[model samples]
Target: MAKKQKEKNNEVILALKAIVEEKGISEELLFDTLEDALVAAYRKNYASSGTENVRVDMNKETGEIKVFSLRQVVSEVNDKDQEISLEEAKAIDEKYELLDMVQKEVTPENFARVAAQSAKQIVTQRIREAERNIVYDEFHEKEFDIVIGHMQRKDKGNLYIDLGKTETILPPSEQIMGEEYEFNEKIVLYVVEVKQNPKGPMILVSRTHPGLVKRLFEKEVPEIYDGIVEINAISREAGSRTKIAVSSNDPEVEPMGACVGPRGIRVQNIVNELGNEKIDIIKWSEDPAELIENALSPAKVINVIIDEDTKSSKVIVDDNQLSLAIGKEGQNVRLAAKLTGWKIDIKNEEQYEKELQDALEKEAKEDPNVEKAIDSDLENLEKLEDEADIEGVIEDVDALKDAKLEEETLKEEEVLESQNIERDIELVPKDDDEYKFKETDETETEIVADEDYEYKVPEEEKED
Candidate 1:
């Protein structure tokens, strides 16, 4: 009977090793769980003993179990089972102090039988808990990444994807529109999130995510996978169309060619996977003008006007390609705008020229009197040039007044002189010839006249 009991203990130890290996659970954790379960069983069966502080110890190698009763050391003991006198505690261990717990073996001989009865049930519960944690951790690492899953079933409006160990939810919002999901069909999906629930880990995945296209390219193209080529941006309308911009890190490698592969085989594979969705893979440019031009592909772009402050672009394409550049209901330009992260406005050459002409006419009509005012001003300027010397007209007013005053004074003096001449005249006879003479204190003067002339001198001179 002793040999048989020893073999039974060995079997329990072996079974613990198997659980740890198979369930990805820590061995130490299982030992702790087993000890706790045994302690609970001992308390429930032996409750009449009124032992409140009981602990269970288990040997890791042999799986041997033991129960211990813990009592706190105190100066005075009131409860015999719970409190031990300091003196008694020090007898057991000299290092023990007041309030310290002293442990004593109290394993019931029938405890082994009870533990055997409960071990299987407790361990199985523990295994399920460990598995839930394992799944949560695994899916958490895969969030925002790509994974292959099989269509499982539909629950209400949500679709379930079988991702091997667990199922992920694909809500209607994330499912690609117009695409059929058949049972057991393999599909590629992007992991949007991983959430933990009481049932297990709840993984939320999507087929319409732009990340799915990026991951598909990474999987198909060696250059993208190896980092020679890099995807800059992606915009998708699931089951309809997608636009992806790519660039090359290495100068020697071409990003577009690398993504397209030899003879379009690589891109074709992706197209087929996405239910024949049209994809335009364009090269990325650092210059906004060049990037906008490239983004509006499949249509010949005449020019691109970029407004850096607004982060917007105006793309001009050929007249024939206007509908293509704008796409059906502006879908083409919309996807381009999303991919380039810029607001795009598309126009054809004829429409752009018409807008330019309309703008000029509108400006002219805004202020109708401007041209008339300008022409009138020009005529006035010309009249001024012919009428007066600009420099002379601009002379100081005070200087002109002074000049006029001086001229008037000179004329007044002349008038005064004429009066003096008329008043001071006189007549006299001189020698045999009749001559008129005027005599004064300072000098004498003679006047000769022609036959028709009459001369006169001052009356005072005649008297002299």
Candidate 2:
């Protein structure tokens, strides 16, 4: 009978070795599963098993489980089932301190075959959890990129995509509007997020992701892949109009034209893949006004007036071009807003002209001088903003006061000097040779002899 028990002990080691080899897991990590399962089995047998916390350490050389039951050190050892006195705890672990949980070795004789089976089950579960974590990390790094997903099945009208080692359940909320997907159809998906769930890792994928547009461009446009062109921004309404802004590193290469391809084939293909969606290939500009104009394509832009503080761009197009600029249901301007991070308003020439007139009339009432002044101040403000040097505040009122005072003094002196010049001519000795003899005199003194000499005088300016 003793020999049979020894044989069973050897069998357990062999079974554990096979599990570690098959799962490609270290024996030490496998032992943790063994310990947890054994504790569960121990609890099922006795109510006092609350004191049981199985500790498992695998021998490095033999890869066998060495089990121990842990108990906390206590002062009075009142609940001896859950805890032991300090002296009792110290018998197993000499370095044991008060409040420390010390492990007491549990021999094979202490447990039955049920505990061994439980231990085996725990090890299997732990190995799977570790494997899932490894898979999660591998896929999480591929966020914002295109990944191929095979349709796994369906759940409540939503499609579940199987990404080989990992699966993504694409919710109906994320599906393209008015678009239908087939079963087992291979589709490209965007990895939106990854999170850890109790069962395993949950990877969220999006069918209508803006990143999908960017990734498609990277795939089709060689300039984008070669670093000659970069996708600056993208905005999409999912299976509808998608706007993408591209910037070129090479001066000669037109990034917009390059993305559009010869005969518009490149972007057209991408559009077809997105349920025949329209694509606008726009050139990216650091200037928000220019970028907004580009983002709203198929419409000629007459002018763009932007408020830097609010990041609003008031776009003016010809009356005939208004609908094209705004697009169906304001989508063109909406996409432009998203692409450039600006609030955009598309106005026809007539609407803009009327708005301009109304604004001028309002300003005339508020400040008449501003209405008289040319709108070149608007251009000047734009220039300042472009140079990133805004807010040119008035330095001081004293400077302006000094300028006004200097102008008034100069005007008074000019009037008085004119009168003095007239008097000087009469004061002369009535000959060109006597011009030097006109003496400096106080103002209002008439040097001209009455009924004797004459001089020409300049006309005075009209009073305001």
Candidate 3:
């Protein structure tokens, strides 16, 4: 019997070792839980009032369990389960006093089925609780970070991402709109929160978080990871677009270009991960006006008028660029406001001019002197215009005089050419055979030369 009992203890020790190894639970914790379960089992099976003081001891080395019932020695026992007579207690120990408590071994022949079931339940509950604590500690350290997980399932529009050791919940508010989740699909998520619960660690993750973009950039862009570039701000409309502001601490580095990478390879990888969502990488500036200008990108801005007191800005764009600045449903301006922490009112050049004119007109009506001031300003402007007109007329007259001199010089040269041609004709020999002549009695050469001279002078005068 002794050998068999030893073998049973050895088997129990081996089983405990297996459980500790498989469950990743501390051996000491398991032992304490087992001792408590045994105590409860003993009270339920053996104690009459179910309130008897029972103690359970387990050997950590051997996994051997012992149960003891504690009873007080009295002159006369009133409760048989709780007290022992002095005479009876003296049989076990001679030094027993009237109020001395004695302990008796009460290992049962067999544990009742109900007690066994209760013990199993207690053990299982304790194990589950230990597991929950372990999981909570593991995930609590990972809060506000990025995690990779696989899509496990969806329930009531909430997605469960299986993150290796535990699962994380993606709430509807954190999920990208119109995004389809597939089973077993690998996805990246940003851990927003971690909570400890009875079941396990409750990890709240997000797909639409701004941190997700920052983390993705850090992962894709080496400059961000190395701290050469820092993300200053981010504004996102999930599944549509995201704007990120980054600045470089190193003077030699261009923050926007670093985030964009060579030929946009860095940002493109992040875009693909986000289901082709558009990303705008803007250079961060310390000046609010320059920051707002960069925040509302892909739209050319004419100027930015900032109100320092109100922390607001009026952005002016060309009339045709208004829609681009405002974006579809005002997404561009909305994101710029978020990124810059300023109230941005976007207006076209025409609208701004009209608004300015209206404000001036209203101001003029409010003050009687404003009208007189405006009249004086108009008079000064007209005088300046008149002076400009006189200057322009003087310049035009000088230009015309220069042109007339050039024309006179051209006419004198033409007259000299005509005289030369007449001399050449006179130099031609009359006897030359090239000049065919009929012998007329009247002197026709002088008449012909004189008629030519008269015809040329009238034609030149007509041209002049």
Measured by TM-score, the strongest candidate is 1
For model 2, what is the error of residue 198's alpha carbon versus the real structure, in angstroms, after optimal superposition? 2.5
What is the alpha-carbon lDDT of model 1 when measured against the actual structure? 0.79
C-alpha lDDT of all candidate models, in order: 0.79, 0.72, 0.79
Off by over 4 Å in 1: 1-8, 43-54, 70-84, 94-101, 115-125, 155-157, 361-464
> For every model shown, what is its TM-score relative to the native structure?
0.71, 0.64, 0.68
Residue by residue across 1-464, what tens digits does model 3's lDDT show?
Answer: 66676677678778878988988889999889888998888887677778787888878776566788899999988888889999999999999999999998877764433455768889888988888887788777878889899999999998888988787878899988888878999988988889987678788899999989988998999999999999999999988999999999999999989988899999999999898999988989999989999999999877777889999988877677899999999999999999999999998755765676676688788986776655644553354334333444568976776666466556645775788533211222343212111213452222122111221232454565
The lDDT of model 2 is 0.72
Global CA lDDT computed for model 3:
0.79
Q: Can you write out model 1's per-residue Cα lDDT over 11-110, one digit (the tens) per residue?
A: 8889889988988889988888888778777777874464678899988887678899899999999887688999999999899999999998988875
Spell out the clash pairs found in candidate 1.
425-457, 425-458, 426-457, 426-458, 427-457
- Alpha-carbon RMSD, candidate 2: 16.1
Off by more than 4 A, model 2: 1-28, 35-55, 59-64, 68-106, 110-114, 124-132, 222-228, 250-254, 257-269, 365-464
Models ranked on lDDT? 1, 3, 2
